[model samples]
Target: MSKSKFTTIGRKILMALSGFFLMFFLLQHLTINMLSVVSPDMFNDVSQFMGTNPVVQFALQPVLIFAVFFHFIMGIVLELQNRRARSIKYAYSKPGTNSSWISRNMIITGLVVLAFLGLHFYDFWVHEMTVKYGGGDMSGLINPNDLDSGYRYHEELVAKFVDPVRVIIYVISFVLLSLHLMHGFQSSFQSMGVSKGKNFIKKFGNVFAIAVPALFVFIAIYHHLQH
Candidate 1:
């Protein structure tokens, strides 16, 4: 194959791989966060383990950070390419209106998600991992229930959720995320050239796109209600 063709294929492959990696990461993250809804104690236990465990702290944390960074960079590159390709301006165009709004505003949604991620890391990660485990700070700003006796990270999470403004932001962010995932889940497969059918795949993709995002929304709402 020609060099240009090879480059295009390689870029697409990287996008697809990074997308899949991030998707799996989201599922894992959701599972861990959802533990708070089930049992605060269990959630705190897991958070303590994740925060303090040498393997996870030293190995998995770096990998997770790299995955997020790669995903964001590739997304920006692909989006710029897409915008450049669509040179013609649309006049009252409603193409793909049947698709979810998230499908249409992925970059915007991604930015929202990224913003929330920063807030999340500061709220939980920095306090639990960096301060507690890394000996950075013990200012009692995070978990206030006696760190020496035992870490109570889960209580901090619940306290954060109780704030009306924070709850609203969390809900809004997750709603956008749901919309983003509605497109992202299936688009990842299509980007990888794994699907060929125009009819069956399209229908299946629509279902998956809606379902995954809805699941996330439900989880978020459930937590909000519990708080």
Candidate 2:
């Protein structure tokens, strides 16, 4: 095969791997968020561990960021190639017939997902890092029922969702994520040549795509209503 063909295949493989890794991260993140709604103390303890864990901070976090960046860059490249192919007069462009709307509009949905991710990092990650590095005054951020806690994980979460605008944006973003995952889940499997038991993969993707995002939306609303 030509170098260009090799590059295309390599890109697709990287995209699929990065996407799968992110999906795992989302599952872990959602589980922790759900815990916050049920048990605030437990949530705080878990958050503290996650924030302070040297391996997670120095290893997994960096790898996760790279996966996100690689997935996004490859997605843009693939989408551009697809667009150029469709622009050719002789190329067939029966998108809906060949694939679902979510699959066709992955670029749009992915962009929305990325936007919310940036907002999320700004809201929480930046603040956490600032406090950790002793640059910001996180003096009064206290958790529920704790006077000595350095950061208020639960309080910060509820405060953000109490804003109706942020809640609406979060809900919309989760919906877009659901749509994106509906196509991406099974598509990733296909790209990686996981053809055995295709029906199971499709069913799992459909259920997971709906359930995970719905759960996340519920978590957001739950926190919003708490305040």
Per lDDT, the best of the predicted structures is 2
lDDT of 1 by residue, 37-68 (tens): 77777777787676667798689889878888
lDDT of 2 by residue, 89-143 (tens): 7554576777678877889999999999999899898888887766543333474
Model 1: residues with Cα > 4 Å off, grouped in runs: 1-6, 86-94, 97-101, 133-148, 196-227
What TM-score goes with each of the models?
0.77, 0.90
Kindly report which residue pairs in candidate 1 clash with one another.
none
- Candidate 2's displacement at residue 83, Å, is 2.3
Model 2 worst lDDT run, 10 consecutive residues: 136-145
Q: TM-score winner among the candidates?
A: 2
Q: For residue 149, give model 1's deviation from the true position in Å.
A: 3.6
| Count of residue pairs whose backbone atoms collide, per candidate | 0, 0
